[model samples]
Target: MNSTHRKALINKLGKERYRTLINNDSFPSLPNDIKEAGLLKKQSNLDQVSHTSESKSRQISPTCAEIKSQQSSHLGAVDFASASTYEMNLESEVVQADVVHEQNPNYVSGNSLTFGDISVPISSCHPYQGFTKPDLRYPQGDDQEDSNITDAQEVFEHASLDGIAAIFKGLVCGAIRTTSPLADGLKPSKASVTTVFPPWGAVDCLLSLDICEASVEPLAAALFNATVKWAEKSLHIGFAGGASLTIPNSEVTLKGVRDEAIAQVFGSEIQQAIQQSRIRIQEMEKGKLTTDCVSMIITEKGAFISLSLGLVQGLEIQKKLYT
Candidate 1:
């Protein structure tokens, strides 16, 4: 049969049945043209399937691109929201910091202002007030008034030469009486001495003494004899006199006598001068006197006393008397 005819028959019988018929030799073998037509038909079907698949892929491309664009836009919106949140948090923190700054008194935000070690705020500062001067003068208080009243009741009198001579005589007798028994291996002696005073007073008397025994060391004996001679000369020189009672063989030394003897001898006169000065101050304070000066000059044959009343101004009565 012709190729066109066989192809038509093969299509009608189907390929498997046709091939079975040809193999049984019940039909003629298939021609190249028919086989080629079969191959061409299969190729056309594959091409159609490939074309449909390409159409499906082309149709899905726009939807995929739309989804990707939607996703990108959603992510951008989320990022913008997060950024806005961060900005809000930062603004809130800044606001809180401002509130905290406002609460503190010492917190200064602008130009730093300082005074010494202190941080000063310009807004809260005021004009500097000058320092107040202290009240350094003496207080005329109730205690001072009471003291003045008490002093007013007492008699104020200047030191007298006669009164001082009597005091000196009593003190000398007391000293000799107390020291005589203590001066062991020594004899009580008497020496007539003259001590010229400053223009204040003058005195002449027989000075008492306790002389060392003849068994004393030669050096001590010579010193005692020399001191006795020097005492006479010193007393004659007035202001330069160093007259003191000597009690040998006693525990007390000549150095102690030089340091304390003048003060001990004139202690009473010093106390009297101090009392008189206080009375004078009391009088001045009560407006009973015109002058605030108090001058006390106590003098004896062997000692001199001069007291300064300058320290009494501030109500401090200090002992500035020197012998």
Candidate 2:
């Protein structure tokens, strides 16, 4: 508590210790001493802080604006490079598409060119025109299809005749009977049957012809007329046509058989005559077929040939009675 004791205590402490205590601001009893110590320590701490902050600021000195401007420059160069590459790719694609379009407009397998108006493509070299395929059987008219039927019928008739004619002529009439105008129906000759083999007595005859008259009718008429003419020439018996010289329907009488013999023996000559006559008849009977109709009848007994003839166009039936 005295000044001497305080002086002794101050001497015991070293000068460095005293300075450390003052700098630390440990003794705050005297206001002036406390103020002076605090001021010295504050000044030293400020100098150290300023030195550290100056070093740190120098290390990270670039401003925010400067950093942003550098980034923008690099990004702009990258963008420009990418844009140039994209434009090149786009132009190449356009050129390739145009070339492909020019080379193959339709893109069809056979032909490259396309028909604008139509859906289907046409070949450059067409093998066929107008029609897809042609039919040779029926050429012209639609109704000509029926002509095939007629042709087939004729062929069948000829085949039938060929098969049976040989057997029929040799066998049916053993004695080989010829025409006898004076004889009546199927009179059996006292002739004995010697041959038992076929074709000696078996006979088949068929007649087929196309006429305005019914199918059987025309055949019968032609055969009848032929028989009558044969009898007149062979027997030297000239009788009136429809009178005594009568040939029944389909019945090969003794006289009628004679005519068929003449026809068969002299076939080529007879056929030629008939063909020539037919041509003349065709010319004469052109429009007459439709207007003045004539019918040829073929019957089981014999054939009939008849024609319609009227001297006066409009006359009563009784007016033309025989006087």
Candidate 3:
């Protein structure tokens, strides 16, 4: 280019544009002349961007409007007027709290169940002294001493004792069946409780007893004769004793029905035995009794307990058999 052409170009462009062209940075950082020319185009682009952003802001989320419309539709569809009588009543009725269980009659309720033991006052006096008793040891005997009891005597004694026991048991049963409340030794019937039904209870129930035999004259004499040989044979007295409780109303017998319950201490067999023991007053046999050597005690308790102590020494037995 010539100096004249360059001069004319510089005169066409401004001083600032001329200076910017002289500095010359890069393609994007254009010269002032080109930048000024494109300003209106750039402003048009900015206006398009602003319009796109405004359109986006004006648009609502897809879900929000739909959700609101759905909520209003649901509210309109509710069957508030079509509610059933039962549901309406239930809603109108008063709500009550849960009921508590009732207390037990047999025990304390709403309290601790722990129990404590009771302490009793003890005697402060000195402990009781042991009884001053005489020496109860048996005397020393000869080692060569032999028993004098024979086999025949032992057999006889056993049979007699067994017979006595059987009769005694039967007699008690018979008394239970035959003995009347009037004749029995029990006290007057009083207010009592019946165990038959506990829930529907009764206060009065009858209680009675019977005294089988008060006179033990035969028993004593028989005991004596039985144990006479024991003293002569063995040093130890022949002792055999035990206790038993017999309930009443054990046997059932009827002539019309021709029925009879098997009985432990009844029937014709037992009755025959009783007849043998039941001797007339004139025919009653009496045996000699030694007060010192013989000791007897018999006790009765309300037809329930019977205790007998039949102690007969050799001398007592001899007296009954011989004298």
Query: For this target, which candidate reaches the highest lDDT against the unseen true structure?
Result: 1
TM-score of each: 0.15, 0.15, 0.13
lDDT of 3 by residue, 115-149 (tens): 11111121221111221334569865544232222
Candidate 2: stretches off by over 4 Å: 1-113, 122-323
Note each model's CA RMSD in angstroms: 39.4, 40.8, 39.9
Q: Rank the candidates by TM-score, best first.
A: 1, 2, 3
lDDT per residue, candidate 2, 1-323, as tens digits?
45555444444432222134323345324434445456556654675465346435434223433543444565432222112111011111111111223222221134322111122223432211122333457556746655654454311111122222332232121212122333764542221111111111111111222222122322323333332332332321123374444443233322221234324432333222322333223534663212111223333423332222221210121121111
Question: What lDDT does candidate 1 reach at residue 184?
Answer: 70
- The C-alpha stretches of model 3 lying farther than 4 A from their native spots are 1-170, 177-209, 215-238, 241-263, 266-323
Candidate 1 accuracy as lDDT: 0.31
What is the lDDT ranking, best to worst? 1, 2, 3
Per residue, candidate 1 scores C-alpha lDDT tens digits across 102-180 of 2221222333333322344434532222223445798799887767655654222222233334434323322221122
Sliding window of 10 residues with minimal summed lDDT for model 3: 253-262
Which residue ranges in model 1 land beyond 4 Å of their true spot?
1-106, 109-237, 240-257, 260-296, 299-323
